[model samples]
Target: MRPMPHDHSDHPHALLPPDPALRVKALETILTRKGLIDPAALDELIDTYENRIGPKNGARVVARAWADPMFRAALLEDATRVVADLGFYGRQGEHMVVVENTPQQHNMVVCTLCSCYPWPLLGIPPGWYKSDAYRARAVREPRKVLADFGVTLPEGTSVRVWDSTAEVRYLVLPMRPEGTDGLSEDALADLVTRDSMIGTDIPKVPS
Candidate 1:
């Protein structure tokens, strides 16, 4: 997917960076011309993965973990198998790890080299998540990066950043919110935001 417009504030006199979409389109055109892939079929596949198979799959997983102690233990012990057993397995998400967020420690995921992520669960990664700024700063200065996302953690809370690679990706299991003991699995799923699963933000508390 094409990323949003980039900032050129640091180099006001320099030309803006090349639009990544232009390069992607050029490659797609060349591939289509070479009969490497049909544009229509390619678009269809992308649409299905991006739209049809969305973050709700992950929401369900998070919700189940929240409502079931056994499942949560299984998830924390072996996330790959737990998710696969629940039919959330796929190419980029074949290897997965779950990190728990606690009162004293917060966990966040980043891809230092590339936008490697759990696609089958989280679906498409957000533009900011794939930005150069996030890839660099999330590791260097996590609290500042999180603050930009409007997530202010307590000073005592230690932020642990996990770098995702092609071999394995991570999902953050945000601590369950209070007053949620009565919620159903689907209701709990509603509270599970994509950013929460990524550890940039916490789950939306039920009112």
Candidate 2:
């Protein structure tokens, strides 16, 4: 047996339903009633973001950077232009900066104000990325946030948190997995997960 979810309408984070599923449903209903959104279009949009556009574009970028030193340097130096060169630039990704994760330091991205993200590369932002808890705690306790996301770093590794805004967005360049030097770029791209690009996880090594 399972207990029912309680309403948190009285809480400070009111307007946000207690359950995230319910929160999204409520928001959808409100928007639909106001004639601000169309249900069919919304469903199609979510489907496109989730399946068609999500992560694959970012994986291509990551794979290219891993296979080419020059591209990696250019990406880290001028992500906005470099990513646009690959045709992954749009509304939310106009001004982009890329951060590299190294042996000694890790980088994480968050937008405390709102859900500013690179839509062309990553598609729609995940629910947690826009949650109040993540927005508030990621900056204050990045290690804990990473831990919550099932990522653990060595004690000596330092974490750097990047705050995103309407003006500038960030893309995390996760370290290329070991033993992948011989893999083709397409195969390597398969190892790059959406969470890895967000700095919440790392690229998986092929079996």
Please give each candidate's TM-score.
0.85, 0.78
TM-score, predicted candidate 1 vs. hidden true structure: 0.85
For model 2, state the Cα shift of residue 63 in Å: 0.9
- Pairs in steric clash, model 2: none
- Global Cα lDDT for candidate 1: 0.89
Every candidate's CA RMSD: 7.3, 7.9
Q: What is the lDDT of every predicted structure here?
A: 0.89, 0.90
- Tens digit of per-residue lDDT, candidate 1, span 40-149: 99889989787877689889999999899999999999999999998888978989999999999999999999999898899889899999999999999999999898
- Among these predictions, the greatest TM-score belongs to 1
Per-residue CA lDDT of model 2 for 95-157, tens digit only, reads 888899999999999999988888888988999999999999999999999999999998789
**Runs in model 2 lying further than 4 Å from the true structure:** 1-51
